[model samples]
Target: MAVEILIVDDDPLIRQTLHQQLVALGYSPHVAEDRRSAEQQLARQEFALVILDLALPDTSGLALLKHWQEAGTSLPTIMISGTATIPDAVEALKLGAADFLVKPVDMFLLEATLKRVLAAQALRSENTRLKQLTRGGRVDFLGDSPCIRELLAQAERVAATEQTVLVEGETGTGKQVLARWIHARSGRADEPLLAVNCAAITETLFESELFGHEKGAFTGAGERKPGKLELVGRGTLFLDEVGELPLLCQAKLLTAVEDRVFERVGGTRQMRFEGRIIAATNRILSQEIGKGGFRRDLYYRLSAFAMRLPALREHADDIPLYIGQALERCRRQYGRTFEPPDDNTLRQLKANSWPGNVRELYHHVERIALLTDGPRIPRSLWLSFPTEPESEPTDIPTGDLRTAMTGFKRKYIQRVLARCGGNQTEAARQLGIERTHLNHLLAEYDGRR
Candidate 1:
């Protein structure tokens, strides 16, 4: 689909210039001469990008930007003005403009900026779509263990309400998945479910990430941006690793959790967060509060309804079922079939401590599927599966399989490529995969590295 861009400017010359340039660049362009017309266009159509003149005759472009911000519009925008000052540019950005341009907008610079912004928006949209696709088929709770049943019951009880929920579990125990299950059952299931990894984002970026920022809020904040909270709208915002949020952020978040209100980083206009907040943390927050690392009040606010996910060890009986499910998923994912693990293999899997819980088990299953050439996974591969050290049998590896696999694959592929003297074709041949597949893997590896 061609990207559609909305040009909101009173000047006919500027509109014509931008429309021609957008057409040259293979985008569909629509024009609105004033704020009223712009509003009508926005209401009637979905635009991938908006070019607004700050000096609209009917109303200030900044006002329109503010309206979109408050209304939770996700449209990316570029602000243009013939009489724009630094403050005007900054204010426009603070209102969620994607870019700001002075009048006599240099065609080259405008095209470049539009491309950059559009590319970023496309990437974000793709990521969200992939996440939803991966999540779409696997909404059921996998195990029938007692603890699993109780967790589902508790989730059902909470899904009917709008109260805040805190999910606690060991790392890789599927806390986020369970949270999604709750959201899927909630009244807001039809809306977006956005997850933010509080631990992955640094403290300095946390505020802008969660509450959003105005243009000029910081040194590199070129345009106004909506935070995750705003993007979630009336859906669910999953705060994964909520405990890792700094104390300062925690204090600010408390208000949103309690009242669902927050202002952008550089603006005073209070915005309403109509979405549900679901926070998950691997840490025992009570201990963090006692250690002065967390706020007791915030903890209280989040824990109005809490659900604890049991570790895989706590439900050993479910291991076989999980193995079967993992095998089926692998078969579908890789387009290959495999015999289920035999009795002896199941016994070893159950006996071994699954510190990484279900996640670890699934990866092991994938690895087995990748390595096996016959109907059954060789029992010898069992020895290659990672296990906890003898001294720390209960301690599992930290982090998700994606991170682990990325690191492992990057290193392994690099070594192979290096051995092949950086010859991609040779490396692919040795790796027993198509050259295009190798190139894709190499691109992903380099991106992560």
Candidate 2:
């Protein structure tokens, strides 16, 4: 996800130029001409980082930063000044300014500073959340679907023990939610919940990641670093997407799981940890074992206490409940009270299959809330499904399945395309797909013509 940045400056040229630069750097930049507009944006929602000019037409940027600190908004702010002095820089730093940059700032330096500040802020938030997780509080596991409820029950039971657990489910099935729930209920509830996406780490960095590395251990090992397992201490180490872990790393992981000890890359000393292991994956482990992608022994160790989350399709009955929940959440987040769907709209909602699951539902709800003029969302929201001509037959009937299916898909696609002003890119964006994917589907339909 791109970071959201708010740039506060009175100069229109500076704001426009920086906005363009920030957008090109994969950030959503919102410009505020003065302190008032900046405060409004800050009050509305949090930004990943803020770039504040030292002088605004209405107020000094230092006062604005202090105001933010007083108002309890902890957004990291970078102070940019054309007439900066040592005392001014010290004062700004004392007021929680992340970094001070002189005006006519080197673009490279500005980008590097923003990246570092944003990364530090993210790490701080992560660490704080981890500390809170270790305080033995109950995690509010969302969703009341039967599948989720059953998973919760299983989790509650498994969390009372120290055995390694393997959670299996498709992506966006809230695997991390279940992992956090387990941590909250476990005996190690008052310890850190260190989560690592095994798939994201490369084979070469696997040892350094799973175990702490000493200074001079390897190139770029400028300082000693503690791995997730060590940072987790006596808490929980969650290995998300464990199925994608490299084959060579799997052997080392299995040994670490068995002995609770590991050596960092280029380090001879062994470090021991007693943290609980919770691994999650979207792939079927048995199938992967047959394909020689995953180790059977490691799978068995992790699956000592196993739970599988049912896909959204199997739990179609819960769609209405989830839709209602998502709408309410969107209303709270967006600060707009949208009326619940009417009877006909609710019926359409129940009929549709949410392939992207809860995550998709949330996005759709947010989009509808923002796009709809009035409070009530109509059946149009439900009519936004992609043109799946071949798949429409199952919903219709036999006899003239091909004709019926094609007619339905074409009508739906054309309606949405028209609503989006014939712009395929915008239509695809509204439908949550790439324009190329939409073109391919349209071509497929054209072939049937």
What's every prediction's RMSD, in angstroms? Answer: 18.7, 18.7
lDDT of each: 0.86, 0.83
lDDT, candidate 2, 281-358, per-residue tens: 999998899889999999998999888988777676666777778778877777877777777776676666766666
Provide the lowest-lDDT 10-residue window in model 2.
388-397
Off by over 4 Å in 1: 1-138, 387-449
lDDT of 2 at 349: 67
Error of 2 at 363 (Å): 1.7
Distance (Å) between predicted and true CA of 183, model 2? Answer: 1.1
Give, for candidate 1, the lowest lDDT window spanning 10 residues. 129-138
